[model samples]
Target chain A: MVTAREEILERLERARPPAAARPAAMPEPSMPIDPMATLRDRLQDAGGSLQFATRSGWTEQIQWPVEATTLRHVYSSLNAMPGRGVGLSSKTNHDLADLDVCVLAAEFVVIENAAAWQRPGCLRERAAALLATHLIVVANATEIVATMHQAYARIAPSDASFGWFLCGPSKTADIEQSLVLGAHGPRTMSLILLSD
Target chain B: MGHRERAREFVADVDRTRWHDQALWFVRSKRDQAADLVPDWEALRDQASAIKRSALTELPELWREFEEHATAAGTVVHWARDAHEHNEIVAGLLRDRSVRHVVKSKSMLTEECGLNSYLEAEGIEVIDTDLGERIVQLRGEPPSHIVMPAIHLQRAEIGELFAKEMGSAPDLDDPTELTDVARRDLRDRFLKAEAGLTGINFAIAETGGFVVVTNEGNADLGTALPGLHIASVGLEKIIPQQKDLAPFLRLLARSATGQAITTYTSHFRGPRPRSTQELHVVIVDNGRSQLLGRPAFREALGCIRCGACLNTCPVYRRSGGHSYSATIPGPIGSVLETSRDPATHAELPHACSLCGSCTDVCPVRIPLHHQLLAWRGELALSGHHPAWRRFSLNLVAWLFVRPTMYRLLGRFARGIGRRLPPTLREDLLPAWTRQRHLPTIPKSSFRELYRERQRQPKRPRPQAQPRPRHERNG
Candidate 1:
């Protein structure tokens, strides 16, 4: 009896479509003169916000007025953000439901969609950013890329296991098309752009 | 039942029907706003369609490349010829680990394969984590819409269901309140489940990995605890290169919803480092290869499951997704259901007014209306049309063949139209006349008018210059 794979291959061979030429590479549209300024606007559109801070002062600036809840900084790189916050582990996955705020460092940020890239090491407990009611990321202004293409190109060196392009806080419009934040994830995502 | 009967039933409640129509129209408007933001929107769609075309043409090669790379990345790859085999492979994976509980996030393929029922029959409990999916699962109904699984339901209906299932407040009708209830209820299931399954949005052959895009972040949460992550992907989801994801990613969120991007676009290259985690990809070909064999219907594979076609479709917006009575619904579903069983889905092709709005909004530019037309022709050729339709069509064809007869018939129609009352004319073609007016017949036929003009010499009236304002007043 022919295997499913061979059968499928045979059918595909029989059903070959007519030859079609590959589309020419699309030209990237020109970016705004101030990509960071545009990025802030787009971030707000996507239910995320941003604040500018000095590189050294970003840690000090990471403060939330919401009281009585857990705050986590999951990444191991202390010098990256220079913060001392509660850490997240796999064991915390069960109890992170009440997490109020989290501040971690993004590998790189995409300006077009305001997506923050998180590589594997810092994202060890995947739920750290997601479970929190509010998430804050501090990244150097130099790490911002103009588009997703640029962001994808920069991921080759990270050896990421579960890399992500987190655009905004978790949201859902499934209920009568009403936009609601904090749907099984962070209600707010605030990025601190640390200028050198 | 035919689309007309089902759609009529769906629209029986006029107020709810209007609400449904406005709701989907809102989504379509949002899509327009998001799509306009990209200057290269059409270019991205073109590239995406072209990439999908090549991917389908060279699927056998890409599948092998994906498998090779995925296996080398410490991921196990499995192939299933059909739904039964696909369910068995997943069941086998779970049995090997003695896993009794599984958490799943919005994989429509599993719904297609009847995986949940199959797993439950084998004594494993499965929980759907997506807020919309969980709602319909508790109600024991299939997803009414592909993207918004419970779109057919109202918030009050959901509130009632949640009250019973999740033990929430009985009178809870607010969307956010109900959503919070679901989140609190499913949080423990995500952490305790032994295995997690998700659907693939795009499977990159170059990296031997896949991407799962979700706004709720349920997939990430579900797979965080369980060391085993099983991604059930259709063969058509495979793209030739990793870079090909750029155009698809840009179009997906904009077309699906108005969002700039989904909250999370998670790229799982391999299983995480510890906890004996493993990434297993089951690439299923059930009926897809057969679809690939038909050139006329081949473009359907280019669909990205955005449901933009559904939102813009007048028929779908009015009739609702459930009226199509297929796993996937709306214009795309109408054509796709025909492939599964043309006789059963024969009425679906007739559901459209053929306005072609679906094609206009399609991210991959699948000629959905044209495909539906083809399905109609094929169905007619197969003699699946009702006897009255066949007879009427034959009568029209016969009348058009004879010039004199056709002219006489036209004259008779004009005479009848002049003599008949408006209400009688509406009864003649109830379907067309129900919501619109019939056109008035002209006093004379075009042929007669042309003959009369030929009998007279052509005369040009004197050109009149425009009068000044004072002269016009005088």
Candidate 2:
């Protein structure tokens, strides 16, 4: 088990951005990923408050905060923001498990795709955290590996973990279509665009 | 609880036949079509799974938020950690409302927790309004399948049962005739029902509504015509929105039965606003909260109570649903039962072929066979297996520890297999192989052949492949 963990760490290291090119100034990437943002905009909008891990903000002083300031900020923005004239978020496969409707201040937020770390091993667990709503994907600008299989091939480790995002403001419409927010889990989720 | 023992009897009773097996397989096929229709079916499953997992991780805050928002929506959200508390709370609510006769649609949770008996004992007459549920209610038997409760019964048996119980003609097996009587009987009950109870399919968090999908349309009538609509649902039924239902509707009905969609998908946001009826939503935990924290059983929540697993399960197909001896039965039933007590359900995990058809058929995609395997580990840890079985398994493992002893025993088994009495080999095998034939053993063991081949190599030649199970002679 220890060896497995070690191997996972080694593979994740290869996927990480080069340490030698660390930015001189980094800020949290907490800005909302314009729900209406097209794929191209999402690809370009991968900086600022989104860089929660390296941020030196007031909220980042905490010890080992896995899901930090940026996520909370984005969650709040998504919560306070009203829905557009559009019907709803069209990119999800919502079923009985997730009610697409969400109460703005819901305690339970459903992150359709969860990744605390970009690695597969902890992504499922990390995205499950209450306030951890961001779904970060490190992808190149070009469509080299659009699918999961191809993504693994480019950076595939014999034991490397892989995961993507399905951010959702978890809700359920189970009770006679009476949309109840936070039936069992988080009521909000905000997707974080990393190297999209 | 009225049919609890009868349910066990029915299971054992039907274990003698394969009627239910074929019916369930048909249901499995329906589910396959439902799943196959959605392009993002796998992604949807993964999202549902991840949502449930995320919910489990943040239960405390989420529950609190649910409480806050639901309360704000004018819903009385009460928490019951167990089945008893859940039932008692519902009973007390009915008692408070002075409800004498309550109409209930099909709810597996109510069965799982046995809420009807508790209500009846409290002097409340509970009527199951759904056609299949009403039939089982009239016969005083438990539902055999999650979707088609009376799937095990042939139309003839149903006709007889209804006649014997409801005083219809004994010879009537026409589905149209039988369905008309049930509909009429339930309609009368629905009109007089003071409290309407239902099992929630998906609870929308954005709106304070709960959705119940049914083919009979009874859930709608029960809740709509009644003064009170009391919905009981496990916490995991929460989905994100109404528009998000396209994929689920495609998957759920097909998975549950094989319909492109159920006859009716009713969404009730709250009690009839401005109407005399009151809406009460009871969120039943009943070990679910505990299960929420558990990783292995967490996926069990994603189940839509579709018994596709039972149809494709060789063990469930042969042994039947009754052997499960739970409110829910079949592959999903056994897996969820483990969340309750490993020692009590020791036989469940063993009663499977682990063929993985259940997972394949599951709309939300729970790793059912893995859960069964995990249950075995739990059963072993709790020291629950029978002595002989454990002894034989251990003894074999110990023999395999010694290379030469294992080979000697293997040869001895081969020798005895070749010379055993024909009748003994045919009729005296274990129950697992009662309908299946034993595989023929070769004169020489594979290891012996491999070792010999190493000493004396021969030219390679292609041979015919082994026949699959369907083609094999049973």
Candidate 3:
């Protein structure tokens, strides 16, 4: 008896249309005039914020809530901010559920949609980005791209086990099409553009 | 019941029908604004369409390449011949691991396979994590719209549901407060779930990776926290290369909800490096192979499931999604459903006004109206249409070939129509004239007016003014 995979593949091969040459690629769209300005505007439209700071001053510029000093649990993977790290050897990801703030580094940012490409190294790091109340991503200002096409060309899928293009904070318009931020993920997403 | 009968019930509620229509039109207007921002929107659509068509012709080789690469990346891949097989495979995996609780993002493919009920029968708790999907799941209802699953329900109704299910205030109706209630409740489910299931938006054959896009980030959280992840994909979701993702990612959110992009577009190549983590992909054919074999209707397989066709369809707006009674409900749904089971869904093709709006807004340019029209012909030929409708259509066809007979019948009908009272005239076609007024009958047919105009003298053409040329004078 034929297996399901073999049967399905056989049927597909029999029913497939005659192979044809792929179409010629179209010309690329022009890049934005000012990538930083476009990224700021688009990020604002997506309900996220963008700020510029030097590598030395970026930590001071984050708008931490007034109560954050005593109760906040900050997890930073960057070299500048050496916050307390979660136990990576934990068996499950549930340990990071109480995290208040998480700061990671993005490979590049796209100007057209204001998405930051972040590749988390492990399962716990990836879960922290979603489980925390606030997500802050820091990237070099020179790494910004004009569109998704340029962003894809810079990265390979095999380079990371998990990767994501996070545009804004988690949001939903599911209830009567009313825009609501902070739907089961980070309430706010802030991107810090480092100059140094 | 058929689409016509189900649509009548929806139309009976005049206020609700009007509200639904306006809500969808608002989204359509937003899509137009988003399209205007892109300078090469049409060229992008052409490129996406060409890429999908090219991929369809060589699906066997692409899937083979995907399997090899995915296996090397430590991902397990499965194949299902139909919905029943798909359900069995998913259930078997969960049963082997003793996974009692699973959190799933919005997966229309699972809805098509009836996976929820199938898993529930095996004593597994499957929770839908998307905000809209969770609402409908609690109410035990199918999603009315693909992108906005609960668009048909109002805030008050959702509030009442939450009060009953989640212990929220009975009178609370604000969308923000209600969403918060759900967010807190779903976060608990996410923490408890042992497995996560999602649907694939695009599967890259070159990378052996797939993308799952969402505005809510539920797919990411659901999969990130859980050690086991299973993704269900239709065979047609395959694309050739990673660079091919650019045009599709650009158009998906803009065409769906007028967003520049979804909040989270996560790519998964393999399971996490942890020893306990696993990633399983089920590639199901169902009836897609038959659809691919059909030359006239094959383009419907190119759909990216953006739901733009549903938002822009005038008929779909007035008639609620429940009227179609399919997992996907709109212009594209009508084409796909009728093709899958022609006899049962014979009336679906006639549910269109053929305004051609759906085709204009389709991200992949599926030519939806043309497919719907072709379904009509196919159904009629297969004897799926009623005998009376077939007979009447044959009579009309016989008369259309004879010019004299057609004109005489038209004149006779007009003369009789003019003599009858307005109410009596409306009674002749009650289905068509129920909510619309019939136009007043003219004294003469169009052919008669044309003949009389031919007898009158034609107006002389205005004399052309000759151009003054220096060369001619010289």
Candidate 4:
């Protein structure tokens, strides 16, 4: 009996046309520009906020509670996260919904879409970056890339099993073309660019 | 029903039809704005098209390499020949895990397989996490648009649906509030569901991984909490290298929603470590190979499902996505559906006005209008058209072959229009004249006017005067 895979493969091979050389890479901008500024502008356009701060200043900046109901702060890193709050590991996935603010370290950030890349190895729970009402990603200024091509060049396939490019707060223009943020993910996303 | 009949029913509501038209036009304008920002936009499109062409040629080899690498990376791989097998494999996976509930991100492939209905029949509950998808799921309707599934629905209708389904405030119609209610409700489902399912946007053969891009973070969130993450990938989604994602990622969101990128573009290499989570990818052919066999229509597989063509299509915008009545609807949908069952989808190829806007707006540059035109030829060749229509078309073609007869017929029609009664004129062409009046005929044909101009005498030109040396030098 011919397996489904074999049948499918045979059909594909029969249908396959002669091979052609792939096109050359798209030319990158040759001019010098600040990737951090570009990232901040892109974030603003996408309904997200960005701020530059020192390590000590970022801790003082995100100290306030955002929502009246369940404003618990959560963080994966033990570094300079603000205020006394519950850690991501302390709560189960069910209770993580009550989290208002989450502070996580970004491996790198892309300027083209203002996306901050996060890895499962760094975050205590993978859901923390997504479950919180408001998300705050901490990234170094030197780690930003001007485009997705540059971003992909920085990482390899073996880096981590789960990684994401979180561009902005969850948004949707579905209902009558009205732009609404926080559809099913964080309502607000803020990126803090820390100078190394 | 034919696309025209369905479209007539949709446009019967004048106000709603106008609203749908403007809303999609607004999205198309946004896409234009986004495309204009990239300095190398055309270059990127060419690169993406070429890359997809190469991928199609190397499909079997690259698919084997992907399966091997993905399997070696601790991810299980399965092959499904059709929708039935795809649904069975997914249902069996859920059954083996004893999963009562599964949360799904937006995966059109699963929709093609009717996976939700299949799983529900097996006593499993499936919750869609994307806000637009969840609204339609609760309303027991298929998605109207692929990117924005509930684009045909207004917030007021969604509020009523949510009030019944999730028990929100009875009179709530605000989009922000409705989105919040869905977010809270789906958050619970995400945390409680035992398994997660997503559709692959692009699967990389070199990296042994796949990517899922969504404006909402539902895909990442759902897979994060579940013990099993099942990605239903079509066989054509495989790209040879990770770097090929650059052009696709740049074009996808821009073409779909005019964004530089989706909110989340998550790459899943394997299951997470030291946990119960596992990754299982089902590579689904589901008639795609059959589509590949036809060289004339094979380029349809290069579609990335961005729905830019739908947004720019006058027919789709005026009639709405439901008119097509397929899993995908619009130019790409029209081609893909006709390729599957030409007889059933015969009306779809004839639905377009041959405007060619879809061809121009397509990021991968698929010759959509040409494909639709080709389908029309095939459909006509199959002898499936109505006798009267075919006879009328043949009569017209015969007249066109003899120019003198054609011109005489045109003059005869003009004379009848001038001499006949209004009722008789209306009866001359009932189908076209039902909605509007016929245009008044001109005195002469353009060919006659051109010949007359050529026969007239030409005026002589005056002699030119030369400039002074100093002025010319200056």
Q: Any idea how many clashes model 4 has?
A: 0
Q: Poorest 10 consecutive residues of model 1 chain B by lDDT? A: B427-436
Question: What DockQ does each candidate score versus the true complex, computed on alpha carbons?
Answer: 0.60, 0.01, 0.81, 0.73
lDDT of 3 by residue, B1-474 (tens): 877777778877888888888899999998898888888899989999999999999999899988988888899999999999999999999999999999999988999899999999999999999999999999999999999999999999999999999999999999999999999999999999999999999999998999999988899989987779999999899998988999999999999999889999998998877558899999999899999999899889999999999999988888889888999899998988887788778888888878899999999999999999898888888899988779988999999999999989998999899999988876554131245578999999877899999999998889998878976777
Candidate 2 per-residue C-alpha lDDT over A105-138 given as tens digits, one digit per residue, 9 for 90 to 100: 2111111111111322221122122222222222
Q: State the lDDT of candidate 2 residue by residue for B1-474, as single tens digits.
A: 212233344445444455555655655675676456445667656555555444444434444455555566556766555688779889998999899999998899899889989999999999987666777777788886676676656778778877887788999876756765555465566657788889988765545555676644466556655567788877667654333343454456556655444434555554433445566777766666556556666668777766667777766665556556767778888888867776676677776767887777676678999898888777777778778668876897799789989889889989999888656786663343345677776899988889998898677888979889888766
Candidate 1 CAPRI category: medium
Q: Which stretch of 10 consecutive residues in model 4 chain A shows the poorest summed lDDT?
A: A62-71
Give each model a TM-score. Answer: 0.91, 0.66, 0.95, 0.93
Could you tell me which 10 consecutive residues in candidate 4 chain B have the lowest summed lDDT? B427-436
lDDT of 4 by residue, A10-89 (tens): 98998887777777777774322766666777898788888877766666654333633345566545367542355544
Give interface RMSD, every candidate, in order.
2.0, 19.3, 1.0, 1.4
Which is the better candidate, 2 or 4, if ranked by lDDT?
Answer: 4
**On residues B1-474, what C-alpha lDDT tens digit does candidate 4 reach at each position?**
777778778877888888888999999999999888777889888989999988888889999999888987789999999999999999999999899999999998999899999999999999998888998898899998899899999778988998998999889999888888888798778889999999999999987899999888889888887779999999889998888998899999999988999988999887776666789999999889888878889889999999999999988988889888888899999999888777778778877879999999999999999999998887788876667757977898899999999989888877766777766676554221234466666677788789998898986878898878889877
| Candidate topping DockQ | 3
Candidate 2 TM-score, true structure as reference: 0.66
Candidates, ranked, TM-score: 3, 4, 1, 2
